[model samples]
Target: MATLIVEVDDNKLKMVKDVLKAMGVSVDKKSIKPEKAPNETTALAIKDARNGKVTKVESIDVLFKSI
Candidate 1:
C-alpha cells in the first residue's frame, strides 16, 4: 500500500473525507490540522465572516469593481 497526501480547500474537506471513507480509506484527521496558527488576514477574514460582514455581488461589474 502507498500513502498519498492531498491539499484541499477547507470548504471541500468534508467532501474529500466522505469520499475517502466510502472507499474504506483510513484518514488521520489530527495530521490534517494546521501546523501553524492562522495569519492575521486569515484570522480577520474568519472573524468578519462569523460577524456576517459579507457583501453580496449581484453582477459582474460590481464584483470587478470591488476588487
Candidate 2:
C-alpha cells in the first residue's frame, strides 16, 4: 500500500478518485486534503485550468511503498 497526494483541480477530485479506484489503488481523501483548506482553492484551480490560469499544476506528492 502507498499514498498518492495529487494537487489537482477541486472539481477533478472526484474524477481522480474514480480513476484511482478503477486502477485498484487505495485512496484516502481525508489524508491527502488540499492545502487551502476550507477555501475554493481546488475549485479555483480547476477553473484556472479551464480558463488557462496556469499552464501546469503547482505540485504533487506521492508516497510509494518501500517494498
Best by lDDT: 1
Q: Mark the regions of model 1 whose C-alpha exceeds 4 Å error after superposition.
A: 30-67
TM-score of each predicted structure versus truth: 0.43, 0.41
Query: Given candidate 2, what's the lDDT at residue 52?
Result: 58
- For all candidates in order, the CA lDDT equals 0.56, 0.53
- For candidate 2, what is the TM-score? 0.41
**Candidate 1: tens digits of C-alpha lDDT, residues 1-67:** 4343344556767876776777787864423237877666556655665675744345434433554
Q: How far in Å is the alpha carbon of 23 misplaced in model 1?
A: 0.6
What lDDT does model 2 reach?
Answer: 0.53
Model 2's number of clashes is: 1
Which candidate has the top score in TM-score?
1
**Per-residue lDDT over 1-67 for candidate 2, one digit per residue giving the tens place of the 0 to 100 score:** 3223356567677876786688787865533346646346555655666775554424432212221
RMSD of each: 14.5, 11.5
